[model samples]
Target chain A: MPCQILPPYLLEKIAACERPEMAHAATAARRSLVHDAPLRRLGDRSLATDQPSPVPRIADPAMPVESGPAPTVDRTVSDAEGSENLPGKIVRTEGGPVTADSAVTEAYDGLGDTWRLYWEAYGRNSVDGRGLPLDATVHYGQDYDNAFWNGRRMVFGDGDGQLFNRFTISPSVVGHELTHGVTQYTANLVYQGQSGALNESVSDVFGALVEQFARGQRANEASWLIGEGLFTAQVHGVALRSMKAPGTAYDDPVLGKDPQPADMAGFVTTDSDAGGVHLNSGIPNHAFYLAASTLGGYAWEAAGQIWYDTLTGGLAATSDFAAFAQATARAAEARFGGSSAEHAAVLGAWKTVGVLPG
Target chain B: MKVYVSRVGGVAGIRLTWQVRVDDQPDADSWWRLLEDLPWQSAPSGPVQPDRFCYEIKAEPHEAVIAENELDGPWRELVDRVQRADTDSR
Candidate 1:
């Protein structure tokens, strides 16, 4: 387990404190990683087959009891019925409303749209490519500052609302969360070390692609940034992370600089949270950016197809960057041919990211 | 009070039952408000019978609080408010 995927230097940074309590917490968290690592290995082995989930059904009060094919639940139920009479989406919208509506509504809408797109675009339904209903929740904590797909439904925090506004509003943010579900369904990639980084990168690639496709933007025209519109104007530039240029996304003093490394040499290899999945995703993020740019058209059409095919076609749980590169190459060849331009583009992109064989 | 949640044809649904010690309970209205306030789109029609109601809440995309005791803050306030209304009518 190496006590976490973070470098000892970064772990030291997190442990920066003379206070005994703070130091003890960090030490304990690091120690806990030893146990978690082996369990993760077990998970990798278990993930080789389709994971079983408790299937959920819609329980609409208005509908009569009838059993046939389940009706596709209309997502815009709250909107369709008048707000005065109908039930509000998640939290109440009108009188005595305890939860904020905008964040929850945005998250809900984004999940629905992303689910629909995944279904409509590639004839794949829902997160699992089955007709699984997409699930999400917003306003998770008082000032929670991150959003994640926690092996199940999507959960979004309201954010500090200072550095980051509501996370649900960004299409890329929702896309990122949904991609985690997709990754869970298909690749079932183990979350640690280089493999974990690739997992994060895959989410970023799909995240940006969802945004690009939503906006009808070509790859060249795309900004290639993840969470581009998430930050308030006071912070600095556009986004929390950038796929096109890895570390250059944000350098503000408050949130700290984006620590993603663009090449294999700079790859982070600590063991916290599945080997710093968020940190090392930079390498794969940059690789996808290169692939999309090289393809020189809508990313969803070519690069997205290659990646999606690779993911759905029985991917190993512990596949690392090199393995992923080979898979993408194989997928591209299977999709476009061994000597095709798309295959060449895939190779070139992996090479650029230093994932390809020397 | 015993609440029953059953799954019928894969559709998980909620059924509510409450026992009252007092006849013609004055706090029933408050209970209705609480039931209506639950974060579910599929609830039964208004309040039902003397002290029973049925509703359904799907468990996905969001989770909701299903039960609360009268001693709890909001729930206590509701019972108090209802009791005061009954006293005034008498």
Candidate 2:
């Protein structure tokens, strides 16, 4: 869901000051885009593996930029030694080559910061516990409004330039994509049905934590909104997605209401896109949001701990929502006593989202 | 080495692609077998193209550099400490 609500063509019409006609066209376009069959069931796919042909690697030493001053970038998630550049350093408008003040730079900085955060805060070097050369592709498609960790590299679209700004600019978005890599290494959560949804939720949790840690904001002091600053003035949505509020993220008439279901019972049962993994993610997304808020501090410090443990531990890969909830509870208990605030936060967060751990 | 995994139906019906680089020479058969053993569902078919021997996993997204020794105990301890400290109250 990294793309903007309004498609570029329509936004262009509106930006061109075609008040009545362009607005009407944009509205119609939005409706069609929303109902666009492929988009509705995004990320829905049966987990089937294909043998990849090995493409020969020709190591070109020529592209080598001097490895600046021995580990110039701490490359650790929490190193705090790297530049304290703000997350919004990269910004892009109109889908032109990435501007220094555009979303791409922000994404690059965010990715590097997140990597450093994990390293400094936890001693973890990179997403895979290895120094993975972080690669990201910004401005993927023309007005192509989505950011994805396409399994190899992070690909971001410029957003239609009207409603959505640049996907790479938001630290949360960068975190979201990078967390996908973490999931891949850990549970490799089945990207279908409830399991798929949990995978998405994990990304959301970690993504928010990256933001909270960078800003030095505690849970209460934080907004708990996923893509708060992503939308422009024309966007009628609150953010790209709301972990705390779930379905309440947006309710604009033209863009259609947010379709995330916050409770287990309300879990969406669909087969369109990998069993609606992204759609059903709302339930777990809400759970993590509540857990972090209840824990009441830097999310990456407490709530992030439990979730990360669950992911890397035996609960990986095949774990579903119920299983994930149980695992999180166990992790909390193992990390903190069963009655500790962190443990309580874990339990309360799941319950708030209608998931009662057994 | 660039490994390409093609799932008949990828995540959300979109083809899922994972590319990884290994320091050693590329081995197709080994990579395919490894991918087959991955936790997620993998396409069951003949080798798509270049056949070599290597470990493979159905890739989803993101990037990483594995130095073989990276997953040793020291790395595990480092990750575990981070996980525990990041979540436990200061």
Candidate 3:
């Protein structure tokens, strides 16, 4: 699934508004809709037919073909240069000198940070957990206010600079997009309804974790905001989504309010956004935040480990919120004793989010 | 006749609508001919792929909702023209 960082509802809000300040946002939203519609259709066809994603897998030109225990971070960053074409021109590779383009440098560093987080924390390789060379394209389109993983590689857009900055400015944004590939290889969660929301939540979980791990921030110390720096001063938003407080992340005259519901009672019943995958993900995201905060230490150690385990530990592709909660509880108990604080915290967190019975 | 085309679905779940009066179109007869030839009445209804688009077409007394991939021939052309019209207006 090619999951985008910004949801369509926000774009629609901007497009429908008549505010003079939002004219650029409206144009950007319209252009993004037009460009993304066909690409999304193509992605759906591949998924429906079980054909490989239209995004071809490109091997790293820098890395040699060798089979060993070498934990190498093979990252290749390309420049789209304001065009929609992807993997445009290879601007920087792993071990290469930094380019003058800040987007390229930020993308390269972000990919490396994500790789280090997974490698050092979970011993997992790249996205596929098998040393799949990381590839990213920066400056993907003309003020295209979104970043996505097209099943094979990451693509970042230079934002309109009013409501959004460059997509690569936030490492969690990069992690969030790349983690879709992780979900693709792991549970391969069906990207619709409750299961789809779980898929989105899992990405957010690791995305925040990746940022936390890179910054050495404890759960309490972390901001718990995804895409923190991606938003400009004009947006009147802290970030794109807040794991700590999902619905409170953003509320602007142009972008409207973040529509994420933090609990089951608020679960949106919508026929769009893959059944509100981005909207309903707030429930589970809040759950993770509660668990991590309650555990009161480095999140990537215990809470992050449990979520990672549940994700890779034979979770069903169609697992709903309750099923996912139960899986995480079981994983916590398996990793820690049933009487351990980790298990109790995991169960308590789910209950707090109304996914599990208290 | 005024034709309204609205697209729903895709990753963001946003609905995009474009309205154009067919009578004002440069190729009004061709547009009507294409619209009439589409299999609008028989379009299936059920779960579609997460990112695939579903289009709702409305022209006064006639309306139909069709999935993007299922659309072919004249329906595709109608959609293309409507999208182009919307883009041009923007």
Which regions of candidate 1 fall more than 4 Å away from where they truly are? A1-100, B1-90
By TM-score, is 1 or 3 better? 3
- Candidate 1 at residue B32, lDDT? 55
Docking class of 3: incorrect
How would you encode candidate 3's per-residue C-alpha lDDT over A90-161 as one tens digit per residue? 999889998889999999999998987776666577998888999999998776667778777888888768
Q: Which candidate would rank higher by DockQ, 2 or 3?
A: 3
Deviation of model 3 at A20, angstroms: 48
- After superposition, which runs of candidate 2 have C-alpha atoms over 4 Å from their true positions? A1-101, B1-90
**Where's the lowest-lDDT run of ten residues in candidate 2 chain A?**
A76-85
Quote the positional error of residue A216 for candidate 3 in Å. Answer: 0.9
> Quick one: ranking by lDDT, best first?
3, 1, 2
Clash counts for all predictions: 11, 53, 2
* TM-score against truth, every candidate: 0.59, 0.59, 0.73
lDDT of 1: 0.59
Residue A257 Cα positional deviation in candidate 1, in Å, after optimal superposition = 1.4
Candidate 3, residues B1-90, lDDT tens digits: the string is: 788888764333335577887877887898788777767677555554434457888876778777755776677678778877766776
Note the chain A TM-score of all models in turn.
0.72, 0.71, 0.81
